[model samples]
Target: MKKKDNVDLLLIEEMREEEPSWTDYDMDETSVKVQLTDTVFDMLLNDTISSLRRIETRLT
Candidate 1:
């Protein structure tokens, strides 16, 4: 079989040899906690708003 352009044949063979663990298909029961202050929250909100506005202007 011919490999596609710039494709990694060795990596593909290695992956095919690997046996997938239960973690690959099963979801773990873990809780994540993030405590963001007002200042950090405002910065993230502003950045997201600006990115959306930029996209909207480009599309219009």
Candidate 2:
């Protein structure tokens, strides 16, 4: 994707609404998988992971 597209997605993620339940668990595979059963969890997880990737890319 283009750099602008990446920035747009990052902004979208940053503005996303999160579930209170998502904060109840560690950012791990098991927790994520269990939460995958819920759309809220899945979207939040994907947004979080995407943000992390963006951070890593900038750091490198």
Candidate 3:
């Protein structure tokens, strides 16, 4: 597997391990929303990078 895939897998594993804590009663909805937004943003960023890589590969 590629280094990027390995990194993403590690991130996913870590997120799964820590996900429960983010839902604790003391945490507010706004915090959860922010986290979700951040996750979406990261996903979009990765998608953009992957798309660019694909385009570059095709061009080459």
User: Which candidate should be chosen as best, given TM-score against the real structure?
Assistant: 3
lDDT of 1 by residue, 1-60 (tens): 356632677777767777465346433332111234556788999999999999999999
Q: TM-score winner between 1 and 3, please give it.
A: 3
Candidate 2 — what's its lDDT?
Answer: 0.81
Note the Cα lDDT for every prediction shown.
0.67, 0.81, 0.94
Better of 1 and 3 by lDDT: 3
Better of 2 and 3 by lDDT: 3
Q: Which tens-of-lDDT digit does each residue in 1-60 have in candidate 3?
A: 699999999999999999989877665877889999999999999999999999999999
- Order by lDDT, highest first: 3, 2, 1
Q: Top lDDT: which candidate number?
A: 3
| Model 1: residue 7 alpha-carbon error in angstroms | 86
lDDT of each residue in 15-48, candidate 2, tens digit only = 5655455675656777777776687877889999
